[model samples]
Target: MKILAFSDLHRDKDAAWSLRDAARAADVVIGAGDFGTRGEGLADTFDILRDITVPVLVVAGNHDNLAEMQAANRGWPHLHVLHGSGVAIGDTAFFGLGYEIPATNEASWNQRLSEAEAEELLAACPDKAVLVTHSPPYGVADLQRNGRHEGSRAIRAAIERHQPQLVLCGHIHHAWGTKGAIGHSEVHNLGPAAHWFEI
Candidate 1:
């Protein structure tokens, strides 16, 4: 399958259009997260993204609320908004988890999950499924400007246990386009552009 994955659009209409146009050649499109800015501006990007006809999988970022996103995308059949959930397309399964894991002190509008909370949410993921998360697993594709690894330990533990086929995430801007590995899974930090992956 051909998958186009991206993240952190942050309400950039041009980027949304870019992804929409890029979806023409992809079988599936994955939006890792950050479609909004501090819980606002989601509609700006969604308006353009709504044009893509492919099966689009998305998760809410720290700047977004899951309920708000689901409500906004209620009528869209092609767009699958996921959080702590799993979906199957063809023969592959995709599991998604969103927001900043292990919590964050950056802003009050930021939605976060503690390590234990993340573990509980991630427990339902099927083994070897494609893992899509807003935060990268601890120490993998999660390096920051300060050289700190801000990923969730629970996420790492889950990766170790599940050994998924691929891990997709975006949050730490410095780690964009970078790839790492946990066990045998390929983890990528997708930025605000189209990344092609074949599975």
Candidate 2:
């Protein structure tokens, strides 16, 4: 199926508009994360996404209010919020864990898990799955402005152990691209806008 992945739009309507149009033409659209500005304007933020014509699979980012987001998405068949959940789309099975690492300060939400907890989530998915997370795993596509890598050690370990088919994520906007593979999984970070690929 054709999958379009993008992230960190952070409520940019122009980008959302483009994505909405692109999404309608594709089989499915995946929003990696950072969909809204935290601490305010949630109602309006969801209004933007509610217009999407195709199936939209989203994972909450550090910038979103999960409770509010969950409420907003109620009864929307086209939009599935994958916050610690999995959804199937044609030939692919999409599994997601949003905000699975802790942030140092305010303006972010972190939910880091132990190796066992990580494994339990991975175990819940079928082998060779399409995994999605807000933050990229360490040493995969996670890079800082100075080229330093900042990602989850546990996440990396999970990928090494499970060997998922493809991983789609975005938390570090600077590392807005793709890394051929990490462990046995191919990793892609679609940040700051829209991108499409055949999977």
Candidate 3:
């Protein structure tokens, strides 16, 4: 399968437009999140991306409002706003967990989930399903500008237990475009750029 993934667009129209063009060639598109800042204007980015006819998977980031994001593309047949849910396309299964896992002090509007909450949500993920999350798993692709690892231990445990083929995530801007690993799973901290993968 051909997968095109990007994250942290943060309402960049040019980036969204570029991804629209790139999506033409992808069988599936993944938007890891933070389409807008502070829960505002996320619909603007989703508007451009919704044009793609392929299966487009999205998750809410710390800066996003899931209800707003879902409302934006309410009945779009190709768009799937996944949070604590899973979807299957062809033979591949995908499970997604949105928000800042382990919590954050960024802003009042920050969407967050405690480690236990995340664990409960992630426990339902099927083995080998593609794991899509807003925050990277602890100790992998999650280093901050201050050299701190601001990731979720629950996410890490999920990777260790399920070993998803690919784990896609974003949120830590400084770690964007970086890569890491957990067991056999590949993890990418994608930024607002077209990242292509074949599985």
Candidate 4:
């Protein structure tokens, strides 16, 4: 399947709209998160993404509220908000976890989780499935401006244990567009720009 993936939009309506054509060309659309600013305007982002006809899978970012995003798009078809869950589209299984580690950062909309919690949530993911997360795995595409790696240890553990085929994430803007490997899985920190991948 051809997947058009993007992340950390942060309420960029123009950039969101620009993804329509790419979405049309892709089999699936995956959004890592940060659709809104400080948990507001997610509906507006959804409105723009509504142009895509294919399945759209998303995870809430540090700037978003997962419950609010789901509530705001309650009636919207083709958009699936995933958190500690798996959704099957065609023959592929997609699993996701949102937000940053609580110990790393704090924000009103940031759905923070502990390392153990993240590992427990990811434990349910099936092997070879697509892992979508708002935070990158530890030491992989998670470098900050100060050169510190801000990533989830649990996420990295899960990747090492489960060996998912692909991992998509976006939180560390400085690390955007970067790719790394964990075990045999490929991990990408997709920025606001759309990235194309075939699986």
Candidate 5:
């Protein structure tokens, strides 16, 4: 299947329009998250992406409210807002885990999970499934501007164990569009621009 993936839109209408056009040729469209600005205007992003006819999968970024996004798209059959869950499209199994591992960040919209919490949430992921997350795995497309690798160790462990076919993530703006690997899995730190892959 052809997958079109993007992340960290942050309510950019231009990016959304571009993604809409890109989605036409894709079997699936995946958004890694950060559609809103500090948990606001998320509905606007959804409105812009409403033209996509294919299956739309999204995870909540640290800047977004998972509950709000889920509630907003509750009635939309084509859109799936996933968090620590799995969904099947055709024969491919996709799993999602959103937000960052909890830290003493000052941002009020920053949603997080502890290392153990993340591992527990990811334990249900099926082997070789496509993994989607808002934060990248440790040391893999997760470098920060401060020259530090700010990623979840639990997430890395999960990827190592499950060996997903592909891992999609965002949040490290400086590492956007970068690619890495964990065992047999291809990991990408997607940006607002659409990325196409055949899986």
Candidate 6:
């Protein structure tokens, strides 16, 4: 299937418009996270999300509250909000998580993911499924000032323990356009912007 993935949009509705254009030619469109102004912008984001003509899946960023996202997606068939949840897209299963660990330079939205939460989510995912998240796994797509890497150790452990087909994430804008690997799974960082690719 063809899927268009993007992240860290920061409330740029034009980017949403551009994504809609990409959705015209793809089977699915996914918004990784940071879709709002510090997670408070879901109200506006929902309107744009509803306009997508194709199936769309979304994950909350540190900026987003799980309850708020759920309420926004209520009764929406085409829009899906996954928080430690999974969805099947054709032959692939997509698993998603929303939060990242706190970094020295980067700020976190709320509580970071604990080992237990990571493991639970990983265990819930289908074998060899596609993983979707708001943060990158450690030493993979993560980067630091002076080029150091700062991804999530818990996330890395989950990928190592449960090798999925593909992992998609965003949060660190610099990570955009970068790809990495964990076990047999390929991980992508869509950054705070939008982009498209074929699955």
All candidates: TM-score: 0.97, 0.87, 0.97, 0.96, 0.97, 0.88
Residue 11 of model 5, lDDT score: 88
Pick the lDDT winner: 3
Backbone clash pairs in model 2 (N, Cα, C under 3 Å; residues 3+ apart or in different chains), count:
1
Candidate 2: deviation at residue 83, Å?
2.2
lDDT of 2 by residue, 11-108 (tens): 78777777777677788888877777654554544566677767788887777776766776675668888865788887788888776453533433
Measured with C-alpha atoms, the lDDT of residue 156 in candidate 4 is 93
Query: What value of lDDT does candidate 1 attain over all alpha carbons?
Result: 0.91
Error of 3 at 119 (Å): 0.3
Model 3 Cα lDDT, one tens digit per residue, 6-44: 999999999999999999999999999899898888877
Q: Tens digits of per-residue lDDT for model 1 on 1-199?
A: 9999999999999889888999999999999999999988888888888888888999888988778889866767798888999899999999999999988757888988888989999999999999999999999889999999888899899999999999999988899999989889999999999999999
Q: Which regions of candidate 4 deviate over 4 angstroms?
A: none
**Candidate number that wins on lDDT, 1 or 5:** 1
**70-189, model 6: which lDDT tens digit per residue?**
776665677888877888877778888876554333544552566566667666776787788888888988885569777777778878877987788887777688898987888898
Error of 5 at 32 (Å): 0.4
- Candidate 5 lDDT by residue in tens digits, 4-93: 999999989988998998798999999998998787878777888977888999999988888888886766668898898989999999
Candidate 4 lDDT over residue span 1-199, tens digit each: 9999999998898889888767889999999999988878887678888878799999999888788878755666888998899899999999999987635666555568898888889889999999999999999999999999999999998899989999999999999999999989999999999899999
RMSD of each: 0.9, 2.4, 0.9, 1.2, 1.1, 2.3
Q: Residue 171, candidate 4: how far off, in angstroms?
A: 0.5
What clash count goes with each model? 0, 1, 0, 0, 0, 2
